[model samples]
Target: MFGDLMGMMGKLKETQEKVEATKKRLDTVLIDEQSTDGLLKVTITANRSIKSLKIDDALLEDKEQLEDYLILTLNKAIEKATEINETEIAAVAKDGMPNIPGMDLFK
Candidate 1:
């Protein structure tokens, strides 16, 4: 029993290290996708928050349309960020505890 407890503690420590490494890897990856025409660009953090947005002034001629496009593009960016998070969570869970059901406690 003591040996098993020690093994579990070792596994937990390894998992914590992997989680930190994964976060660092994600931090370097850019989720900055832009509109098709490049009129709008959005940068999102690894944790799914908007870091910044750049809009070309040329799109402002049609203010309403620009507004709508901005909304749409930001939504797309948000979705992309969420997908990244899901992928990361799954990867970490699978790496750490492949045999457990619903092991995504880190997300």
Candidate 2:
């Protein structure tokens, strides 16, 4: 029993390390999103950090329109990034989890 417990603890620690590494890797995974009209483009990392923004000159002429575009496009980009991040982390965690009786975490 004690040996099993020790192994489980080690596996958990390893899973934690993998999760952190995956998060760091996600920083390099870029997600790009553009407005429907292609007037505004955004590049963000899977970690949800903004990398760059490209705005057309026409968008620059109207403050309100620019704000609206930014809000809509950025939200979409963030949603994509969040999905990637969560899926990657969950896969890592689920793969590393020890199979304990009556514990079906991944399901």
Candidate 3:
């Protein structure tokens, strides 16, 4: 019984380490998305931090259209980042952790 408990603890520690490493990898991932017309672009990290934004000079003349395009472009970048984050996190969970009852519900 003691040996089994020790083994389980060891596995838990290793899994924690893997999770941390995976998160670091995720943080470094960058997702870039742009508007359909290519007038606006946004770059974001997998952790949902904005890295940079680019706007076409032509769009600057119209504040309303520029704002609308910016909002749309930003949302696309964030959505891509979220999709990648979810996939990476799910893979990490599946690979590093043991299956538990009711865990599928969360996934």
User: In terms of TM-score, how similar is model 1 to the real structure?
Assistant: 0.72
Range of the 10 consecutive residues with the lowest summed lDDT in candidate 1: 98-107
Question: What ordering of candidates by lDDT runs from best to worst?
Answer: 2, 3, 1
In the range 1-107, model 3's lDDT, one tens digit per residue, is: 68776776887688788878878898899998999999888889998999998999999999999999988889888888999988887777677665545666435
Candidate 3: regions farther than 4 A off:
99-107
1 against 3, candidate with superior TM-score:
3
Candidates' TM-scores?
A: 0.72, 0.98, 0.84
TM-score of 2: 0.98
lDDT of 1 by residue, 7-27 (tens): 767887787788778877776
**What ranges in model 1 sit over 4 Å off?**
98-107
Residue range 35-94, candidate 2, lDDT tens digits? 999999999999999999999999989999999999999999999999999999999999
Our tally of clashes for model 1 stands at 0
What C-alpha lDDT values do all the predictions have? 0.78, 0.98, 0.84
Best of the two (2, 3) by lDDT? 2
Q: In angstroms, how far off is 4's CA in candidate 3?
A: 2.3
